[model samples]
Target: MNRRRTSRSASAEELLSTLQHLTARAREEVGLHQARVELAQALQRKMLPADLPAFPGVRTAARYAPARDGLDIGGDWYDGFLLPDGALGLAIGDVQGHDVEAAAFMGQIRIAMRAVASTVADPGEVLSRTNDLILSMDSSLFATCSFFRFDPVTRELSGARAGHVAGVWATSDGRSGITSDAGGLPLGIQSGQSYPVTRRTLDVDGAFVLLTDGVIEGPSLSIGDGLEEVRRLVSAHAGASAEELADRVLRAAGLTGHEDDAAVLVLRNEIPSREAASPDGG
Candidate 1:
């Protein structure tokens, strides 16, 4: 009996030792995973635009949020800059993934789109060229994007979609709707895809919004409902500043606990009031 008790005690000690070893290993793995997540988050932040360009008569705001439930990062991105001809160029896209590769691909696509937009003024052509560039690459990844060139002076806004979510627009008089423009396949799918362009004039005080699908779709929510919710919010708060509008959209989308990354860009056409535009106060 004494020998049997001693054997059982030894076995218990061995089991405890193994459990300790496994616990330590798990902690190390968790630490490494956390470090990787931080690194990927930093890379994603670096890839995105640090600031949305500021232009007279136009107010722009952008927001990016990572998935709330994972260590991996996603590829939702947005960009705004001034074109050579004084038009405001805006873009939002999502690469197909939730890892470091997706983030890197997003950076490459953003750079390519900017380079193409610099020489190509047509929104449709810009997307086509970008598609060509992606197809030329050695990657098998695909991306969806919405590109727009807004001429503040003429109130003309031309946009093209590449399997991306359609943008929403609100007129100064409180009319709002989702864009109905036709779109082509996502980039990297085919070499000769053509993205159709949709052009409209944004009246003074009007606003346009672009966002990734993650903003509208989730585990329990359908995209259609999400879009209608966003449209209602925009219409109800059409007079809010661009920044406030962006924040409201994210908050309403429950981004704090969302499972996918999301991005949003808001552009508001603001003409100075007669009193402010007048010299010597009229």
Candidate 2:
């Protein structure tokens, strides 16, 4: 009886020690994961544009959200910048994965596209050049991107979509819905792919919503349904500020419990009050 009791006590002590060790290891892993997330977020911030270029005739706002259930996040990004020719450029894209490499590839694509866009001027040419750049990188990954250049002076919108979901376009006091167009293949899939360009006039006080697939994708809802939801949201809030509209769109997407990282760019054609004075000159 005495020997059995001693044996049982020894086994309990060993088990307790093992449990304590596991608990400590688990805590360390959690801390390490959190640190990784912070680092990844910092890298993402650096990769994305810190400020949207201040163009007088266009109001632009962007938003980015990491995956809710990810450790390092994914390669979803948005950017808006003023081109040398005074065109307001806006872009959003998603690389083909959820890893550091995806994010790195995203950065490469963005830089290449920006350079190509400012110089090329044509939206289709920009994506075509960017596609060539991606093909040259020898990466197995691919990306879906959309590019838009607004000629505020002419109230013209030129866009090129590369196998990405359709985006929403609206006039403040007029009709609003997803614009239809022919988009080419996604980037990195082929060496000499060409994206078709779509042109439209914003008329006045118009807005465009450019986003990644994650924005209109969820488990329970079909992509079509999600798009309709976005359409409703945009139409309902046509007169809101760009910043507010961006937040609201993101909030609406959040309610869908999107598992992928999401990025949104909202561009409005309203001229700033200050720019109103300068008009065409500004």
Candidate 3:
């Protein structure tokens, strides 16, 4: 009996040792995963623009929110810049994933679009060329995008869509509606897909808004309802600054608990007030 008891004690010690070893390995794996996530997040932030370009009579602002339920990063991105011909170029897109690979692809797409838009004046041509470039890449990922060119002098807002959600616009007189732009397939789907351009004019004090589907779609909320909510918000807050309106859109969508990533871009045409433009307050 004494020999049997000693043998049992030895077996129990061996089992405890194995359990401790497994526990330490698991902790190490978790720490490694966390470090990787932090690094990816930093890299993703660096790819996006620090500030949107603003020009006379047009103010721009954007907001980006990452997925709340995952360790992986998302592909949603937005950009605004000046083209060679002096028009303001605005773009928003979503790559087809939520991983480190997706973030890297997002950066590549953004850069390619910028390079093409710098020389191409037409939004459709810009997307078409970018589509070809994406097809030439080694990855099989696809992306949806909306590209716009706004002429501040003429107030003409023209754009093209590539399987992207339509933008929303609100006029100074409270008229608001969703855009009806025709679109082609998402980029990288085919070799020669052509995006069509849609054109509209922005009334003074009007605003145009762009966003990714993550801002609207949720488990219980339908996309239609979400879009309607955004439309109403834009109409109601027509007087708000572009910055404030962008924030209100996110807060109204209850973005804190959203499962997917979200991004919003607001471009408002603000004519200088006579009093402000004048030397004296008249």
TM-score of each candidate? 0.93, 0.91, 0.92
lDDT per residue, candidate 1, 10-126, as tens digits? 999999999999999999999988987888798899999888887777899998878874456899999999999989999999999888889889999999999999999999999
The C-alpha stretches of model 2 lying farther than 4 A from their native spots are 69-72, 271-282
Which residue runs of candidate 1 sit more than 4 Å off their true CA positions? 69-71, 255-257, 274-282
Better of 1 and 2 by TM-score: 1
Query: What lDDT tens digits, residue by residue, belong to model 3 across residues 178-208?
Result: 8888999998789787888998877568788
Number of backbone-clashing residue pairs for each candidate, in the order shown? 0, 0, 0
Model 1: lowest-lDDT 10 consecutive positions: 249-258
Assess each prediction's global lDDT (C-alpha) against the native: 0.87, 0.85, 0.87
What order do candidates take by lDDT, descending?
1, 3, 2
| Candidate 3 clashing pairs, residues 3+ apart or interchain | none
Candidate 2 lDDT at 138 equals 96
Model 2 C-alpha lDDT per residue in residues 144-196, reported as the tens digit of each score:
98998888688788999998888987777868998788999989999888888
Would you give me the overall lDDT of model 1?
0.87
Error of 2 at 125 (Å): 1.2
